[model samples]
Target: MHNDALCNFWTSTLGERPPARPRLTAHLQADVAIVGAGFTGLWTAYYLKRLSPALNIVVLEAERVGHGASGRNGGWVVGNLAGLERHIGGLSLDERRLCCGVVADNVDELGGVLAREGIDADFHKGGAIYAAARYRDQVAIQRGYLQHLHDLGHRETDCCWLDAGQLAEKARFRDGYGGIYHRQVATVNPARLVTGLAECAERLGVTIHEHSRAEILERRKVSTGEGSVEAPTIVCATEGYADGFHDFKRHVLPVQSLVVATEPLSESVWQEIGMAERPAFSDASRLINYGHRTADGRIVFGARGSYRLGARSKADQAIGEAAMRMRRDLLVDLLPALEGVRITHGWGGSLGLSRNFRPHAILDRRHGLATAGGYAGEGVAASHLFGRTLADMILERDTELARMPWAFADASHRQLIKRWEIEPLRWLAAQAITFSYAGEEALMRRGKPLPLIKPALQRMNDYFASVIE
Candidate 1:
């Protein structure tokens, strides 16, 4: 087995690693076959067993459980979806409210599941603070975001603007220029959550085969190197780790994201940092920086990552020293109290970004296929919601989750999802977007009066966001 400690801080918290599960060595038959035993697969297996105990289900993973983004994420259980407007932008206000409420309530639902399963994953729901820290221009950017959230159907109680004082009371960012206080966000140890969920699904009679990479996938069968499983329904939950295994990678490509955890801070340092509620926090940067106070008194932080050429997925856990240093610098910039803190762990993993930017749960009954993913880095909570939705759709249950805008039952993914552009085009577009965003951040940091350049660059970025996101 791979060294879990070297993977990330979260797996190191698991103490000694559990015994490895047996890989698939013989053909088997089941009612459903799930690919990739990550959050989406495990959650779907758990829900399917709960809703129908008689159904025989099997899950196959390329590595150990939570080997992908499920085990390596920054652990933010955001209530909102990435690129949510794409899904419900044209819906009525009441319809949009229903969808938003479903997502917002998912955070609490996940917490409840953890409690019921007796999983001590350090689940906390102190909310999140999207602060406009650093330069003065960020305040306008954040305010515009809060307005956009409201326009997208978030309730005032669910997401409210915090003045500078209120923001400081929540999180002591350097400038703390007032931002949005979203009440529905929470954090968890993603590694623990995924491992515990896998065990829970096993207890419910879901067979899982670790180190069983699906080399071939057909309408009713998924084959690993030595064995295959034939089922009435097949689920491809590989997400960002698809790695050209199937056409899923074409619709949902992998983007690399890295994270680092600081050593446990002193009480005095905590006091200076001011996250008494342990709310997740992030500055207003398109580069997408976010972090939270861990239960062990450390700050677990990460930022937006990049896409690799050919859409390759990250295989190793270790990140480069320069990348770790960059994240450390960003963390210290957000909270100057951590100027000399030690960064004990750094790791990178791939996350899925769909062509449409929004997430989906699709079940094609005619093809005996079901899949749920493209979370765009919000898969921690989005996976649970979509997993449950997939279970409902597969079971043909007439439920609200199955009727949501993101759920599709009658169409194949190839028909509903657009394929990504070919190699150099995809790579070039990603590079252009990254460079443009970095340029905008550079201008923000200058804090000067280049009115024409700043606004023009901002407008260009807005166009880019509209097109890509």
Candidate 2:
């Protein structure tokens, strides 16, 4: 997709956008020129400013600030790794466990970072819930949830299993068995967060240039629209919209996801349908439905990897129907207490999906040419995590936090799906999954279950695109 950077789910609704200082129209020199004014770029500049108050830093963006998937995504800031577990087949169990700890730690650290900086992006710390709808999903949750946690030796956490009665009381859902609730997830107005960091960066002497698309780059010179920037180091923070970057093309596939927001329902709406035991909640599905209620009582909901990221995808057309359907059906499916509330706004965003699912990258090819992307769908945490690391690496400042398990090297995939065709194949795969699920449901209705292809389907989802329910 062209990414349509303007139609951000979070930014569009905001009353005002941050003032654009100006675009980089002339040659400039800086200690670092961070590209892409999203979470990664902003944070890189923010942390760099924190480290050296006098460091000359300039951020270059192709569009307005927070225009990428960073500001245009579901507000869920999950502790789960972006593409972490997918690489486990090649890692020792202990190694995987350590990596998982890093993700969990990233979750905690972000809270502190936001708090310490006194930046309020409407961040809510009430945590999240992972709901189970059907028996198939329940079994998968039961099998994977606890074991994965134990293998990683993660934080002490418990799953609150609600019985049919308790489920009825906790969340006003339509129909289901029971569900699992995992705590410690958060939601925020991501646009505010990104803009706040940019403001802080500028206050600390870092310059940000918006609407300055970086077309080409070298170790010292980053080519942009009107002119180019010469810096000691060049950091690329562009995620799924890696159209012009050859190295990032294979590792990450741009996925278009849909989201919608409703006009504030009544108090009964929040008390009844919009309530989550842990505040934020998601279902156990390949193309998952994720949502949380805002402090203002509006429900902001989204789906991941639901479409391919390209101008040719149907995601744009799907938003209206998707919003209506999600509100009418899925809302009732999860909570039946309130079904008729109207959805006022509907939108979609593109995400940078990684092959391995883990989002982290740092490079300095020459003296200083670095890059980072592949947030998968968890850029909220990964973007902050890697942005700090990328900045530290650029300055040659060493810290345990900067020493991530993975770095942006020559990560590429030969069998990678092309961007132009990504959406069609992705939509096809989505239909296939729907058919598979329907077939399974039908056969199970007929007392004939395959039982074998479920894992294979999950593997495809884990490795490919999770575009189906």
Candidate 3:
């Protein structure tokens, strides 16, 4: 599909786009100036205004609200962070559990906020199933992952093993070996969530300017083409779409991810597929894949994405025909009941990946700067927690959220977050990892016991994951 011909399934659900908010045309001063109107920025604005209704806040967006990865994600409101271990690995057991509890509770807290704000967004807390569906090797891979999660202080009640029969009761996968049933996960229609959040922030007295791209970000000022905002604090919330705005792109590289949604299936077909609980699911593959049963009876699926050579952010929603077909084939391979199902939508967007593979919410009080991002494709829920944390930090509230390990107070991110490797080296490393993972997956699919090559490739991939995941 061509860029112009494609449409995002989530946006399509919104029926029509609302009129664009006016671009910044007059110099403005506020208590806080924020860049980017996606989940992080709007969530930060929302919480800021809610916590202190008298405070003045202004939000600047390069495009429309939810136009970035916020509207383009796979819709899984995961309760855990993607690079979580890196943050909690060094903490004491009790402290690690505290952080994990905070993270796991974030899903319900987000849903509660949505309910209180009356934003439908199809919020459903059916949890998630990380299945070992394709091959026998996946069984061991999943078991190891479960152990790792437990070691990271995730509660056993929140994350436990489900045997083949229990897994089948939840989701009837092709092999259905076994899986981890994570109880703290849920899914949401991301487009609705982001748009509704922008509205909620506005209702909370936030001034939002669409199409006002932040050209320069100074200590306590942000400049657009025709206007600028000066405030006591400045926030840069542009994650994967950071582009050349300030030095954020250097710290958080943008990687492109694509997703596709199938046409609504018949009730009988759904019966054969057996996602009756509508839980999110993914197989144990290095080529990452995830999907869920939509409230509207469709299946939305996405897989591993690629890193552009120059770390360029994707602007368009459309993806090529080959990329769409590849995902469709993979989906069918995982769920044979959808052999002839038609795919209704295919789109792509960029997501931020930090050099250290850890998400952070930083407040440089000395420099009057605050930022939160590098979600690593799990921004849907993390954005909320980090946004609230940023608000608490900016408010100087001595709350537990402000004390979380991932929340850095009074420190410059440049000093804390490492910069990504320069272009060619970064691109070359990404390609090498992709090829290695593909080779490993191919060997696994063949189901032959190539003892030496398989074990060696697995070990090498594990090392790569440790470095970048």
Candidate 4:
């Protein structure tokens, strides 16, 4: 099957689009040349034009807009930070608070933009719930939630812990002991959001060229097969597709995440699930998981999936049937009432995993380069801030967004995920780690002691701890 068919449920419902914008056929000069047409690139262009209308901006896209993770994501516009204090470890409480505030504001800011721009992406800021179904998850989430507040020096009102009764008001997850509720998260049809942003950018006079793949990007040039773009400033916004370019292949590793969507459910089904407001939900597991209620009344869930051998992020539409079944089983475990629901769609996309695991937006005026990515599947809301901050930095403004931790962070740090090992060993290690996680999660589900994988889990935990420290 064509990936375009499996890429997104949001796009599948949009009928057919008008033909894509013309490909670049002649060398062009612009004040800014962006290399990707996804959220990061479009958001940056939108802000730059809004900041200075006369600035010439051109966006080159290897594929159509939102063809990557931006469109294929679980549609949760959340405020969760990709890497908390670990990404900015030495920062004081004041600095951490500022970062958290920016993230929270980003969600609201995106809503405002959608309203003012006359774009309807089915956005609903109903918030999210983190379920702790198992006893182990319950204890872990409690500690993590308290530490989260403590780390930010935030009061209890910022985020509230819900008892089982309170959690019942939010969701009806099976075996749910407790949960955390934050009122800032939102859900949107991401494909509509990205495509709408592209249209808005065009209306604002930013030129977009699809199918213009940049084979070579230099100090003041981006050479594509069809044409070239010459500009003093260039931005690389190609997130998970960064490996396609020589300059970025080594710095970013693309890891795949898979998602499945069920057929539209009846109103009674939703009432039984208690997700009337459609708040995004996920459990407390190291292997990441997330889900949201779609606008069409379907439940879409996703999680970390089988990594490719050697971490290669190519177009592999075959996301093993076993992996898909496991994810479906997990969804049922969370909400047992959905056991009989039919799964209508299944797909996968890659997220850029940076060397240091931090979502970075850096402006190197000396090199005439500015880039932002490695979002680790949290880019929906973060990309908006990243784009605005990168624009501010390029404009030499001393705005609060520009001064945020990730805005100007160092990108040279090395971490375990970033270290490139030889093929078979790297592949083997990934398999072993994933197997251990599954075994551990199964044990936790059974209410059995996690002794079998405790040592392995501890070693893994210790390695990440050492890196953060």
Clashes of each: 0, 13, 0, 0
lDDT of 2 by residue, 1-469 (tens): 1324333446655666557769888998888888888898888888888888888888888878877777767887776654454444367766765666776667678888788888778877766656565444554554466566555544556344556566555565554555655554678888778877777778778888888988986757899869888887788787777767665554556677777776676876666563644377766654467888877777777765444424222323235564556544665556655567677566675777655455566565454677776666778877877777876776677775555566543332222322333556655765676565554434433433456765565465544433221
Which has the better lDDT: candidate 1, or candidate 2?
1
lDDT of 1 by residue, 177-207 (tens): 8999999999999999999999999999999
lDDT of each: 0.91, 0.66, 0.92, 0.79
Off by over 4 Å in 2: 1-9, 86-98, 134-137, 158-170, 274-278, 305-318, 322-328, 408-469
Alpha-carbon TM-score of each model against the true structure: 0.98, 0.83, 0.99, 0.93
Give stretches of model 3 more than 4 Å off: 1-6
Q: Residue 159: error of model 4 in Å?
A: 1.6
Q: In terms of lDDT, which candidate is strongest?
A: 3
The runs of at least 3 residues in candidate 1 whose Cα sits more than 4 Å from the true structure, single-residue gaps closed, are 1-4
Q: Judging by lDDT, tell me the better candidate of 1 and 3.
A: 3
Minimal lDDT window, size 10, model 2: 411-420
Q: How good is model 3 by TM-score? A: 0.99
Q: Please provide, for model 3 over 1-469, each residue's C-alpha lDDT reduced to its tens digit, 9 standing for 90 to 100.
A: 5532256888888876778999999999899999999999999999999999999999999989988999878999998998988888999999889999999999999999999999989999999999999898899999999999999999999999999999999989888999999999999999999999999899889999999888999989999999999999999998998776658888999988899999999999989989888999999998899999999999999986899988889888898778889999999988999999898899988999899889999999988999999899999999999999999999999999999889999899899889988879999999999999999999999989999999999999999998987
